[model samples]
Each structure stands twice: as structure tokens, then as C-alpha cells.
Target: MKKLIEVDHVSNERVSNVHFSLMEGSLTTIIGPSGAGKSSLLLLLNRLEDPDKGEIHFKGKKISDFPISELRRNIGMVFQQAHLFDGTVEENLKFGPSLRKKWEQNDGVKLLEKVQLSEEFLTKEVENLSGGEQQRVAFARTLANNPEVLLLDEVTSALDMRTVELMEELLHKLVKEEGKTILMITHDLKQAKRLGSYTLFMNEGKVEEQGETASLFQHPKTAALKHFFEG
Candidate 1:
């Protein structure tokens, strides 16, 4: 697996001295308490915010070298809340691609199906959907741009257990079948262990531990990580 994203000595107001690499076709989970810079990291990755110090490289090139539009299109992000516009699902799905002039008539249905939504969802108003449905729509909307990576921020935190489980399944399918590289922030320890091939443990805006999920969970090398798991 080639390195898809490399964060080298990155620092910002919320995080400090951070470094990590995400492999292509991998699903890596970032887990920690509030103020751990988990969300901050994602912001930098897609250039929603740039790091005050250090650099982020994607696919062996400096991220800053790419046009902002192309950078964001390839590194799509979905926030904790579904930030959809007041429109039908098809319209929302078409929003990104249409802005880039890449929209095709069949794009809405294809994007919906990728996120496990049916073709019928294309015509439905987004406001009429449930929370879980809306989140899936948001995911599908991001997919409309055909990003190489997906950054997820506690996307299932507000959902029911069953819906969370189903969302987890969808994420797995995205990585395993659709070949997306994902970096997810999750408050659920069990979900992190279940979904992430690799896990990054952060504390005080720094990466305290990172490794294969099974090893990181079973043999935490730092006291903060051990306490995190214990508590």
C-alpha cells in the first residue's frame, strides 16, 4: 500500500508536532477526547485551514501546490452535521459536480447507489429525510466529486445504534470495494477498533500512539493511551 497522505511535523493552533501517514485504500480512525485536534487535522488535510507550520503532502506532492478547487475535489470531507442545501437529493448530489462542470444526468443515481441509497432518493426533498438518511445523502454528495479520499467527522454520533451499524457497513464497503482512503473521527472506541485498519490515538493536540488497530488497542505504549482505554 502506497502512502496516500503524509503529515510531516504539522502544527497549528489546535494541534502540535503531528506526523502520520495514511496508506491508499486504507481506513484509519482518529480517536480522542475533545480538544485533541482530531477535527483540526481534517481541516488542514483538505485546506479548509492550512497549518501555521509544516506541510501536508498527498501522493508525494505538496498539497499547497495543487489548485484549491482540485485539492478539495479530490480530498472531499463530510462533517458531523449534514450541511445540505434546501433542495432535493438529486440537486444536492449534483451541486459539487455541477460547480466543476462535471455533472452527468445519471450522476445522482450512481452516487446515491454508492452510498447504498436507492434511485428514488434522487427526487426526494432533503429536509424530509431522517437524520441517518440525510447523513447518507451527505456522503453520497461528497462521492459525486469522485474524491480519492474521504474525511469523516463523527458522522454517526447522533444516529441510532442500528443506523450506526449500517453506516459502519457502508464505510467498510467504501474502503474494501470502492477503494477509498478514509480518515474518520469517532467517539466510539468499539467502532474505531471495528472499522479502522489502523488507529491513531491523540491527546493534548498530539499523536500519542498510532499503529495497527489490534496492536494499538491491545498494547498501548503510552500512559495517556492506556488511561484512555481504561477510562
Candidate 2:
């Protein structure tokens, strides 16, 4: 598979000398203890926060070479908390595409369906939706931009177990059908194990171990990783 994004010795206030490559159409989970820089690493991917040093390349070109808006649109981000505009769900879904003048007549309904929301949701107010619904709307809104890569920062953390499971299912469908490259951050080891095709285990701002999910979990090579699974 092609490498969609490459992180080369990236560093920031909270992250240090981190390195990894996101494979196209792959789901990679970033896991570690609190203050391990998972969120910081994600911010660098979408340019929400720039690294103090090192470079990030997208599709063999430097990320800095791409226009910020273009780069961000192609690499969308969904945070733990869904931030919706004070408007109808359809309006929120239209926000990103409208900015780029790429709005389609059926985009709102199509995206809603993609996120498992019905057409009727188009008329509902975002604030009136439940947490799970809001998160789904957020995902749909990001999808409207037609991003190739999705940087998910603990997107399921605030959701209930059922909601989280639904979100995971939706994500799997997206990977299988839409071919989205997802880089997710999670504190839940079980969720990571279940969803991640590849896993990166970090500590003290550095990646300590990384490999296929089953291999890393079943045969950790580092002492830190062994203790993490054992404990």
C-alpha cells in the first residue's frame, strides 16, 4: 500500500521526535497513558498545530508545500466534542462545502446517510440532537469535504458504549466502502485492539513500540509495552 502521510522526526511542546507513516486505507490507533502526546501528534497532522521542528509529508510532497486550506480540507479532523454551528443539521453539513464552493444539491442527504442518519435529520437543529447524533453529524460534515484522511482525536470518548459501538461499525464501513485513511487516538485498550489494524504505543512523548494489532498485543517486545498490556 502507498504511504499517505509520513511523519519524520516531528516535535512540538508536548510531542518529541515522533515518527510514523499512515498507510492508505489503513486504520491506525495511537494509544498511551495520559500526557503521552497523542492529541498533540494529531494536531500536527491537520496543521491545527505546527511542529516546532521536523517535517510532515503528504503523498510524497511536503505538507508545507500544500495550501493550508487545501491540506486541511483533504485531511479532516473530528474532535472529542462535536462543535456544530447554531443551525439545522443540513446547514452544518453544508458549511465546509459551501466555503469551497463545492456544494452539491444532494450532498446533505447523501452525507447524512453515510453517517447512518436519515434524510429527516436534515431539518433538525444540531443542538436538539443527542451526543451520538451530534458526533455523527460532525462526521458527516467532515465527509462533505471529501477528505482522504481523517484525524480522529478520541471522537468516541464522550459517547455511550452503544454509541461507540455504532461509531466503530460506521468507521469500518467507511474503511471498506469509502477507503478513508483513519488515524485515531484512544485510551481504551480494548477499543484500540478491536479497531486498529496497526497500533502505535507511546510513552513520554515518544513511540515505544508499533506493529500489527494482534502481534503487539500478543507478543510485546519492549518492557514498557509488556507492562502496559499486563497491567
Candidate 3:
């Protein structure tokens, strides 16, 4: 796998000395308590927000070398809340590719299936759909672009147990089938281990512990994560 992004000696207003290298076409979970700068890390990758100091390279090139619009298009993001436009479901899904004429009907339908939604959802209005349904639509829209990386910011937080489980199952399959390089941030340890092959545990704006998901959980490296579980 290629090293898509390298967070080298990064120091921001929120975090300092955060360094890590993320591989392409692999799922990496950023696990931490709230305010650990995990979301900040994701922002750096997409260049939505820039870092104060350090080098962030993508595909062996500096992140700044890539055009912001083009970089964002290639890295699809799913927020905690599904920010759908005030339109029909079909219209919302068509928003991105409508301008570029890149996304297709088959791609939309395939993404809908990946998110475990029926074709009937395409016609429904966004306002009428439930939270879970809306998020499924958002996930479908993200996949519409065939992004190399998927940044999920607490994607399952507001979802019900049933829906979260369903989406997790679908994401697991998508990673293997599509070779998606996924970076997901979650407070839920169970969900992280289930979804991530590798996990990084952050505390006080630092990566205190990190390892394979199974090993890290079973044998935590830092008192922070240990206390987190014991408490």
C-alpha cells in the first residue's frame, strides 16, 4: 500500500508534535476522547483547514501542491450530521456530478445499496427522511465521486444500534471490494476495533498509544486509554 498522507512533526494551535503516516487503500481508525484533535487531523488531510507548522505530503507530494478544489473532490467526507441540501433525494445526490457530469445512475444505485437503502429512497424528499435514511443518502453521495479516501467524522454517533450495525457491515465490505483508504474518528471502541485494521489512541492532543485494533484494546499502552476503559 502507498503512503497517501504523512503527518510529520505537525504542530497546530490544538496539537503539537503529532506525527504519523497513513497508508493508501486501508482503513485507519483515529480513536480518542473528545477534543483530542482527531477531526483536526482529518481537516489537514483534505486541506479544508491548514496546519500552523509541519509537512503533510500526499502520494509523495506536498499537500499544498494539490489544488484545493480537486483535492477535496478526491477525498470524500461524511460528517456526523448528514448535511443534505433542501431538495429531493435524487437532486441532492446529483449535486456534485451534475456540474462535472461524472457520477452516474449506476454509481448512485450501487452506493445506495452499500448504505443499505432501497431504490425507493431516490424519489423521497430530504425533509421527509429520518436521520438514518438521510445519512445513508449522504454516504451514497460521497461514494458517487469514487474517492480515494473516505473521512468519516463520528459517522455512526447519532444513528440507532440497528442502523449503525448495518452501516458498519456495509463499510467493511466496501473497503475490501473497493480498496478505499478510510480514516474514521470514533469514541466508540467497539465500533473502532470492528471497522479498523489499525487504531491510534489520542489523549491530550497526543497519540499516546497505537497498534492493531485487536492488540491495542486487549493491552492498552497508556494510562489514558487504560483509565478510559476502567472508568
Candidate 4:
């Protein structure tokens, strides 16, 4: 597979000398304890926060070379808390694409279906929806941008188990059918193992270990990783 984003010695106040490549159309889970900089690392991916040192390349081109607006449009982010605007679900879905003059009449409906929500949700008030439904709307809104890569920061942390499972299923479908690349930060190791093909284990702002999820979980190479699994 082609490399989508390449990180070389990237660092910030919270994230340290991290190096990795996210392959196209792959879901890579970043797992670590709290304050290990998992969320900090994700911020740098979409230029939500820039690395104080090192470089990030998108599709073999320097990330800085791309316009920030366009870059963020291509790389969408979904946070743990779904922050919806004070409006209907359709308005939330149309927000991003409208800014770029790419909004379509049916975009909202299409995105809702993609996230496994029905058409009726389009007219529902975002604030009236349950947490899970709101999150699904958030995902659909992000998808409306037609992003190539998605940066998910503990998106399912506040969700119920069933909602989390549904989100995982939707994510897998997105990867398989749409070939969207995903880099997700998840504290749940079990969720990582279930959804991720590759996993990055981090600690104290550094990458402790990384490899295929099955191999790394089955045979942790470092004491830290072993302890994490054992714990």
C-alpha cells in the first residue's frame, strides 16, 4: 500500500520524537495510558497543532506546502466529544462543504446513511439527539467533507459499548469500501485489537513499540508493553 502520511522525528511539548508512516486505506490505532501524548500526536496530524520540530509529509509532499484550509478539508478530525452547532443535523452536515462551495443537495442524506443513520435524522435538531446519535451525526458531518484521512481522537470514549461497536463497524466499512485512511487514538486496548490492523504503543511521549496488532499483542517486545498487556 502507498504511504499516506509520514512522520519523521516529530515533537511538540507533549509529543516526543515520534516516527511512523500511515499506510493508505489502513486503520492504525494509537494506544497508550493517559498523558502518554496520544491525543497530542493526533493534533499534529491534521495541523490542528504543528510540530515544534521535525516534518510531516502528506502523499510524499511536505504538509506545509498545502494550503491549511484545503489540508484540513482532506484530513478531517472527530473528537471524543461531539461538538455540534446549534442547528439541525442537515445543517451540521452541510457546514464544511458549504464553506468550500462543494455542498450538494443530497450530501446530508448520503452522509447520514454512510454513518448508519436514517433520513429522518436530517430534520432532527442536533441538541435533541442522544449522545450516540449525536456522535453518528458528527461522523456524518465529517464525512461530508469527503476526506482522504480521518484523525479520530478517542471518539468512542464517552459512548456506550453498543454505540462503540456500531462506530467500529462503520469505520471498517469506510476503510474497505471507501479506502479512507484512519489514525485513531484509543485508550481501550481491546478496541484497538478489534479494529486496528496495525498498532502503535506509546509511553511518556515516546513510541514504546509498534507493529501488526496481532503480533504485538501476542508477543510484546518491551517491558512497558508487556506490563500494559498484563495490566
Candidate 5:
């Protein structure tokens, strides 16, 4: 498969000299201890934060080469917090496509359905929704833009078990069927192993080890990774 994203010796306040590549249509997970720069790495990838050194390339072009609006539109991100606007679900779902002058009334409903939310949710207020419901909306809003790559920062951390499972199922469909590339930061080791085909194990601001998910988890090459699995 072609490389979708390439990070070369990238560094910032949090990440240190990290280098890796995410293959097209692959589901990869970033696993590490807290403060390991996992979230910071995501920020740098989408230009939410620029690296102090090195560079990032997406689909063979430097990320800096793309216009900020275009880059963000194609490389979308969803954070742990829902971060929804103060409005009804329909409004939030329409935000991205509307900004790009591509909005259609049916788009919101379809996007909601993709995230397993029904059409009735379109009229409901975001603030009134439960944490899981709000998260699904946030995800649906991101999907409204129809991005090629998704950078998820612990998006399921606060969700209940049932909702988390549903979100995971949706993510699998996205990769297996929709053919989007994904790199997710996850604190749950089991979720990482189960959800991702490839895994990057990070610690102390660097990717200490990376390989196929099962192999990396079963036989950690670095001491930091071994200690992480043990802990």
C-alpha cells in the first residue's frame, strides 16, 4: 500500500525526533504512557500545532505545501472532548460542509446514520445529549467533511463500554469499507491491539518501538514498551 502520511524526525515541545509512516487505508494505533507526546503528535500532523523541527508529508507532499483550510479539511481530527458547538445536532453536522460550500440537507442525516445515530437526533440540542451521543455527533460532524485521513486523540476515553464498542465498530467500517486512513491515540492496550493492524509504542516523547499490533504487544522490543504492557 502507498504511504498516506510520513513523519520524518519531527519534533516539538512534546514529541522528540519521531519518524513513522501510515499506510493508505490502514488502521494504526498510537499506544503509550501519559505525557508521551501522543496527542501532540496528532496536533502537529494536522497543523493544529507546527513542529519546531523536521517535517510531515501527506500523500507525497509536505503538509506545509497544502493550504491550511484544505489540509485541515482532508486531514480531520477528533479530540477526547466532544467540543460541539452550542446548537442543535443538525447545525453542528452542517458546519464543515457549509464552510466548504458543499452542504446538502440530507448530508447531515446520512452522516448521523453512519455514526449509528438516528434522524431524530438532527433536531435535538447538542448540550442535552449524553456524553456518548454528543461524541457520536462530534464524529459525525467530522465525517461531514469526508476527510481522507482521521487523527483521533483518545476519542473513546470517556465513553461507556457499549458506546465505545459501537464507536469501534464504526471505525472498522470506515477503514475496511470506506478506505480512510486512521491514526488513533488510545490509552487502552486491549483496544489498540484489537482495533489497529499496526501499532506504534511511544514513550518519553519518542516512538520507542513499532510493528504489527499482535507482535508488538506480544514481544515488546524496548524496555519502555515492555514496562508499559506490564504496568
Candidate 6:
């Protein structure tokens, strides 16, 4: 397909000169050590934090050229924590679209079902749910926009393995069938390999190496890769 996101020498003072290109209709994993700027790079796509000197383009249009509302709606982001407001689950889902965020209840619920959550949870209070449930709700909320590009920041890092599996299955579907572009930051290489077809192995805020998931993990290119897998 086309290039959905083009990040060239993307450097915010907080981050480093990270260079990468995420293709359209594909799932690309951003893996690296702590403070490697995986999450920072995710934020840059929507200009959550501007790059000191670099350019980001989405669908051949400069990200800087997009209006805030238009840009955010097209690029949905899920943070490390499940940040649900103190309200019923449905309210949280509704809130995003109600505020003119790009979303459709029908399509969003389909995505939610993949995450293994029922529509019944919609009426339940968000705060009462467990961590896994909260993350599921968060996933539904993120899909509220039906974004072309989904930015996931270690979304399952806090959940247990079972919860992680559910989230992984949902993400896998998004990448494979839904044809949505995804840029995910992950600490777990197992999760990365399972969910991402492409991989960008980063270290100290730069891409040390990148390739297909199986090849990169099976015959890792750098010493950093060796240390990362060993540790």
C-alpha cells in the first residue's frame, strides 16, 4: 500500500534522532529498552510533542499541516495505562464521539467484541472494573475514532498474561483483517513477534535494526538485540 506515516530523523529534545517509516495497512512494532524513545516517537505523530527539527507525514500530507481535530481523529492513541474516566463504560465511549471525535458506535462495538468485552459493560461503572477490563474498555474507547493509524504504547504492560492474550488477539485482527495501520511500543518481544509483522529494534533512542519479526528475533543483528533478548 502507501506510506501511512513517515517519520524522518524525528527528534524532540526529550527524544533522539529516531528515523523510521511505518507503512499503510500494516502493524509495525517499536521495541527497545527503557528511555529508548519508543513512546516519544508515538506521541510525535499527532504533534502531542513537536519534533525539534524533523518532518512527519501521514498519507502524503504533512502532519504539521493537519488541523488538530482532523489529525487526532485519524491517529488514535492508547496509552500504557487504561485511563477511563469515573463514569459508566458506555459514557466513556460516547464521550469521545460526543465531543466530535471521529467514531461510530456500530463499528466501535465490533472492535470491542474482538477484545472479548460485551456491550453490557457499557452500563457498568468504569472504576469498578478490574485492570484487564479497564484495558478492554480503553481499547474500545480508542477505536471510537476508527482511526487509520493506531498508536499503542505498551497497552498490555500492566495486565496479566490472559488479559494480554485477549488484547493481542484483538490487535492481531486489527492488523490482519481490518487493514488498519498500527505502530506499537512493546517491552515484550513475544508480544511483538506475535502481533507485529515488521519490527524496529531501537536502543538509546535510535533504530539499531529493523526487519521481519521472525528474522530479527531468530538471527538478531546487533549486540543490543543479544542483550535485550538475554535480559
The best candidate by lDDT is: 5
Give the per-residue lDDT digits (tens) of candidate 5, residues 76-176.
99988999999999999999999878999789889988989999999999989999999899999998999999999999999999999999999999999
lDDT of each: 0.93, 0.91, 0.83, 0.91, 0.94, 0.83
lDDT of 6 at 129: 94
Q: Which window of 10 residues has the lowest lDDT sum in candidate 5?
A: 100-109
Candidates in order: C-alpha RMSD to true structure: 1.1, 1.2, 1.5, 1.0, 0.7, 1.9
> What is residue 199's positional error in candidate 2, in angstroms?
0.6
**Candidate 3 accuracy as TM-score:** 0.94
Cα error, candidate 1, residue 37 (Å): 0.6
TM-score of each: 0.97, 0.96, 0.94, 0.97, 0.99, 0.93
lDDT of 3 at 159: 92
**Lowest summed-lDDT stretch of 10 residues in model 4?**
107-116
Candidate 2, residue 7: Cα displacement in angstroms equals: 0.3
True-structure lDDT of candidate 3: 0.83
Enumerate clash totals for all models, in the order shown.
0, 0, 0, 0, 0, 0
Model 2 segments beyond 4 Å from truth? none
Query: Any idea what lDDT model 6 has?
Result: 0.83
**Model 3 C-alpha lDDT per residue in residues 128-223, reported as the tens digit of each score:** 999999988988887777778888999899899999999888777768887788889987878888888888888777888878888998999788
Better of 1 and 5 by TM-score: 5
lDDT of 1 at 119: 93
lDDT of 1 by residue, 1-231 (tens): 999999999999999999999999999999998889999999999999999999999999999999999999999999999999998999999999999798999888788876678899999999999998999899888988989999999999988888787789988888999899999999999999999999999999999899999999999999999989898
lDDT of 4 at 65: 92
How many angstroms is residue 130 displaced in model 3 relative to the true structure, after the best TM-score fit? 0.5
Q: Residue 223's C-alpha lDDT in candidate 6?
A: 96
